[model samples]
Target: MAAFSPELTVIYATIRTLDDQHPQATAVLVGGGRVLAVGSREEMAALAPRAHVLDHRDLILTPGLAEAHIHLVAYGFSLAELNLHGARSVSEVQARVAQRTMNTPPGTWLRGGGFLLSELGLDEYPAAAVLDEVSPHHPVLLFSRDLHLGWANSLALRLAGIRPDTPDPVGGRIVRPLGTLLESASELVTRVMPVPSEADFLAAAKAGVEDLAGRGYVSAHTMAFEEPEAPRALQTLAARGDLPLRIWACLPHERLEQARELGLACSPGSLFQWGGVKFFADGALGSRTAWLHGPGFAGGSGTGMPLDSPDLIRERGAEALRLGLTPVTHAIGDRANTEVLEVYEALRPLADEKGIRLRIEHAQHLRPEDIPRFRGLTASVQPIHLQADGPMIRELLPHRVDTSYAFRSLKAAGAVLAFGSDAPVAPPEYRANFAAALTRRDDEGQPIAPAEALTEEEILWAHTRGPALAAGWEDEGIIRPGARAAFTLWDRIGGNARALVL
Candidate 1:
C-alpha cells in the first residue's frame, strides 16, 4: 500500500531556519501542517511540482514567534477595560475613571489597571478619597501595572466590607486611609465583583488568540494568574478550531492536588496543554512587595512581603515534576530569587530524573553568585519590563543593579532564556523587547547593566526557540522538515512582521 501524499504548499522566502544543519533556505515545502522539506526554491519546486506556490522572496522567514508569558483571557478582557497605562498623576487617573463612570450606570463596578506608583509620581499609597471625588456613585477598582496592588474608591471599599481597621488577610495587607489593598487583600474587593459568564470567557479567549496571531505570534504561554475559566475558554477555542495560536498553560499551585486527583498531566501535541505549575515567591518591584535582602527599599519600605512559602513550592513542585510538569516559580527581588534557587537546588535531582526543567519567572533581580546556579534551568523573563522597572530598580534596589534583567549572564550560565511580554502588565510588543534587550535602556533613557544587553539574534532565539523548549514543544520554534508549518514573515528581523498563514 502506498502512503497518500497530503496536499502541499511551497513557501518561497529568505528563510532563517535556526537549524544548525540547514541554517538557511530559499523555500519550504509544507504538507498536513508540517514542514515537508527545506531547500532552494528550485529544489523545492522540483520536488513538489504540483504544490501551490506562495512567493515571498523579499521577506525574511523564521520560526513563528511565541509570547512566553501572559494571562491570555485576562489580556483579552483588558482590551475593553479602562486602561491606565500612561496615567501620569492621580488627577489623570481620576479623570479617566470619571469619564468611564459617566458612561457606565451608577453602582456599576468599574475596573481597570496599568498604573505604576512611580510613574504616577506618588510618594505615598494613593488615598481612596481622591477617587471618591470623581466616582462616588460607582465602585472603582484599579490595579497597579504589576497587579500586586489594588486602589479602590470608598464605595468599592464599602462594597468589599473593607474599613480602616479591617485587619489584613493572611497573606495580604490593607494600607491606611481605607483605599489600597495589597496582595491577597485585593481579592476581598474582587471577590464581590460580578464574575464573567461562559460566553464572556469564550469571547475573551478568542480575542486574545486573534490579537496575538495578528501580531505574528504563533504560540503563547498563558500564566496561571487568571481564573480557572480562562484556560477552559482557551480549551473551548482549541476544540472548536477557533484558536489561532497554540497555548501552553500553567495551573496555579493551589490546584495541584485537584489536578492530580483529576488525572491531569502534561499532555502535549494539541493547540492547548497543561505544561507548568506556577508558584509565586513574592510580588512585583513596582508594588513594593518584592521580598528583598536586608535594608530594603530606599524609603524604609521594609524587606518586602513574601508569598507561597518555600516549603510549599518544594513539596508541590516535586508533585508537579512527578507528573512531568515543569515547576515555574515567579521570583523578582534578590531575596525571592535566592529562596527559589535554594528550593530549586533541592528539587534539581528529581527534576533531572524526570527530564523536566525548573523554571524561574521574572528572574529580575539576582545576586552575582546565583547567576551560575540557573544552569540548565529556564529563565522565563520579560525584557519589556525593563522599560518601566529600570528607574525603580535604581531607586528601590540600587545594590542589585548589576544583575537586573541579566539576559547575557543567565545565558552564559547555561539557562535557556525565554522572553515574553507579561501582557496586560505590559503590551506583548516584541519590538520593545528587542530595543530594551539590545540597548539596555529604561524609560528614563538610563543604561541598566549595558553589558547584559543581548544581540538581535539572541533576542529572536529567546522569543522563538527558547519558549518552545520551555513548553517541551520539540517540533515548534524552528523551520525544518518535520517541524510545525508556522513561520513569521518579517520586513526586517525585529521590525514589521506578520504570521505567514498558508
Candidate 2:
C-alpha cells in the first residue's frame, strides 16, 4: 500500500532520476519525505491536483549528496581551532602557533591539525624544542595532515606523562626526540584532553552538520574515530529532532564488547543509526605509517607500521557481523590491503549468511595480485586525498603510482566505490572530490592514474548510490518509490550543487 503523505508536495526540476528504467524526469511529486511519482510535469501535476509545487526546472536534480566518511564532531571543533592544512614550513607552523598563543591564555591546552611533513619540507620528525620557543607556557598538540601522527610540545608531553624513559605502547611509536607520537601513541596524549560537556559536543555536531549542509551534503557517514561522547551528542540531537543531517555512525571495534553488553542492535532511528564497526588496519600514506610491501618508501623507512592486528580484526569483525553490522577496516597500503583481504575472505561465509557486506575504509594502494580480492566489499575512499598525496605517492611509492587511487580498477572488480573527503583532513567539498576523481591529477598537474579517472555519471553514483550500499540504506541515493525525497540540484553534473529536501 502506498503511504499517503500528510502534505502533498511536488518539485519540478530537471530530474536525473538515476534510475535505469526511467533515467530522467521533468518533475517529481514527493510526499511523506519519500518520492511518490517521478515523471513529466504535466503528468505529475495531473496525478496530484492539490500538491504544493516547487518549481526549480532550471537546475539538475539527483539523490541527496552523502559525505560517506568524516569524524563529525571533531570536524566541527576544527572549524574554530587552528587550521594548518597548507602550512608550507615548520617556521610557518611555529608562527601560526605563536600567533594563536598570544591570543590564548597561558597554560591552556592548544590544539590544531592539518600539516604535511612533505609540505613542511621536513624528511624527519620534528622535536619538542621547536615548539618550546613559542609555546613555553602553554601545552600544545598539533596533528599531521593524515591525523595518524601528532607533534606535542614539552608541556603537553609532560601532562600525558610521556617521558623520555617511557616505553612505547603496543601498536604505536614515540619519535626519538620525544616530540612526535604516531598511531596509537598519539591517542595516549589525546586521552588527557579535558572531556567536553554534552552541550559542547552537541554544539560541535551542530556546527559540523550545518557546515556540511552549507556544502550541499544532505547526509554523512560519521566514521567512529572520535571520543565516545561524540556519537552520544549526535544521538541526543536526533532524539530531540534537532539533527539536520542523516547520520550513519560506526563503532570502534574496541567498543564491540561494551556495545554487545548493552544489547545494541542494528536498528534504524529517526535520523541517526549505527552501521559499521570500524577498525584501523594501518596508518595513512602521508604519515609514512601505511603498511607496505618490501621496498617500502623509496628513500624512507620500514614497511609502514600496522595498527589493528589481523587477529583482532578477524575476531572483532566476526562479532560485528554477528551483530548485523558491517565490519569496516582501514587499509591504505598494499600489505595492509592484502592483510585485510585475507581477513575478509575468512569472514565471507559469515557475512554472506548475515546478508551484510564487508567494507575496507581506505583501499588506497594495492598489489595487482590483490585487486580482485576486493570483490563484494565496499571500497570507501577519499579522492580528495589524491590532490595532496599525489606528489608524495610519486616520490615515496613510485612503483605503486600506476595503481594508486585505482578507482576504475576497483569498480571493474565489482567492489563498491563509495566516495568521500575524509574531512578535517580535506574539506568536504564536492567540487574537490569531483575534480580529483574525474582528473586523477595532482596539484602538479601530473596524472596519478588517468586511466582510473571516472566519468561524471560514475562519480555521482559513487558519491550517491555507492554510499547508500555501504550504509545499507535501501531508500536513499535514488529518486523512486520508497526512496527519500532528499535531492541535490546541480548547476551542471560536476558543478556546484545544493540540497533540496521535501
Candidate 3:
C-alpha cells in the first residue's frame, strides 16, 4: 500500500533513525504528524509527489530529545526567582537576597533555589543571622542546589513556627539554630508560603515549556515535585494548543488518593498527559540526606535520611501500577536504591501484567549487587549532575563513586538509561549532559571514573530512546513509520541541538 499523501518530507544529510530496521535514513516522509516513510531523499520525494520539502543537507537529524526528569513549572517560576546557581559564598547569597529584598516589599516571600552548601565553601550550615542582616524584613526561603535542603532566614523560620526547640519531622531535619531545613522539614515553611496562583502557574508552565523547546527538548517527563496547579497549568496550555512540547507528568504519591478519587489514570494526550505517580525514596546527596548504607558520608555522623519508607512505596506502587500509572521512585543513595529495588521486585509482576514499566529517578548511587535489580526497569538519571556532584561524591562517598551515575553499567544490566538535566537543580543543557557522561569529570576537572564514561552513541540513546520508553512513548525518540515526526537537528552529535518539529 502507498504511504499517506499530502506529506511533509524532511531531507537531511545524516539522520540517525534510532530504528534498527533502517539505522540510517536521509529523509522522512511525515503525514498527519506521524512518520509515513523513512528512506533516502529520492525515496521520500517519490513517495509523496506533491509534498512540502524542507532541505537541510548539512545538519544531522535524530529523534526529538526527551527530558527524563524535570520540575517543569517550578523551573519556570524559578526563572523569576533569585538564581543563586553560581554564588560561591554565603555573602553572595546574602547579596542576592538583599538585592531582591531591597527591590520588594518587606513582608513578601522571597523564594529561590540552586545553591549548594559545598559551593558556599561551608563545612557547616550558615546561620540565618547573615540573611537577617541583609533582609531582616523579608521572609526568605532559598533552597540548596539539590532541592533536598532549604535555607531560610529568621523571619521565614519564625513565620513557619520553626524554633530552636522545634523537633525535626520524621525523614527531615531542621538544622539547629534555624538556618536550614532538610527533606520534609522544608515543607513546614513551603506549605505555609503562598501558593502560586493559577495565572502564575500557567505563565510559568508556558515559560518552562518554551525554555525546554528552545534547548531542543521536544518532550519532558515533568516529575511533579510542585503543586497541583503546576500540572494544571501544563494541561491548560495543552488544551489551548499553546504548549510547545509534549509532557508526561507524574503525580506526587501524596496525591495518589486524590487521583484515584478523581478516577484518574494514565490517559494519553497529544501534548500533555499524566503518566506516573512519583515518590521520593530518600533525600539527596548534596544535602547528605540520601538514605545511605553506612558507614555513610566518610566523616559524617549520619547514614542519611530516608523519606517515604519501602512499605509505603510498596503499597502506593501497587496502586499506581493498578491504576495504569508507572510507579516512579527517586532513589539516590545505596540504601534508598536497595529499598526501592525490594519494592520494585514485588511490583514487577504487577507492572508486567499492566504493561507499564516501573521507573527509578536519580538512581545516582548504587551497590554493585543491586545494579542488576534495575533490569527491565527505567533508570531515569541526570548525567549533567555528575559535573558538580562528582567531586562531592568522591569526597563524601568515595567507595561508591565508581558505581555512582553508572549509566553504562545500568544499561549493561538491562536497565533503560533515561538521561536528563533535572533543571533548577541543573539547567536542561544537553551539552552539559554530554560532557558529564562522556568525560565523567567533576567541575574541579577531576575524573570520577573514566571507565564509567559512555560513548557518544550511548549518550544519544540514553537521552532519546531511554526517556521515550520510561514515559511509555514509543512514537517519540525514534524515527520510523508510525512514529511522531518530531525531531531534533544537531550540528553534530554531542554538540548543539535544536528542535525541528513540523
User: How many clashing pairs in candidate 2?
Assistant: 0
Return the lDDT, model 1, position 51: 84
lDDT of 1 at 457: 86
Q: Please provide the root mean square deviation of candidate 1 (C-alpha atoms, Å).
A: 1.5
Q: Residue 484's C-alpha lDDT in candidate 3?
A: 85
lDDT of 3 by residue, 1-502 (tens): 5744563655555999999888998888887788888899888767777888788778899999889999999999989999999899888988888888878986999998898888889878777887889988888899988999898889999999998999999878888777888888899999889987889889999899999999898999999889889999898998898988989999999998999999998887568888999899888988988889979998865788888889999999999998999998999999999999999999999999999989999999999999988999999999889988977888889999789998888888899999988888889898998898998888899988688889998899988988998888888889998888789998999788889887
- Pairs with backbone N, CA or C atoms under 3 Å apart (clashes), candidate 2: none
Among these predictions, the greatest lDDT belongs to 1
Better lDDT candidate (2, 3): 2
lDDT of 1 by residue, 260-311 (tens): 9999999999989999999999998998999988888887878899999999
Estimated TM-score per prediction?
A: 0.98, 0.98, 0.98
* Window of ten residues with lowest summed lDDT in model 3: 3-12
Model 2 earns a TM-score of 0.98
* Candidate 3 clashing pairs, residues 3+ apart or interchain: none
lDDT of 2 by residue, 107-157 (tens): 988999999999999989999989999999999999987899999999999
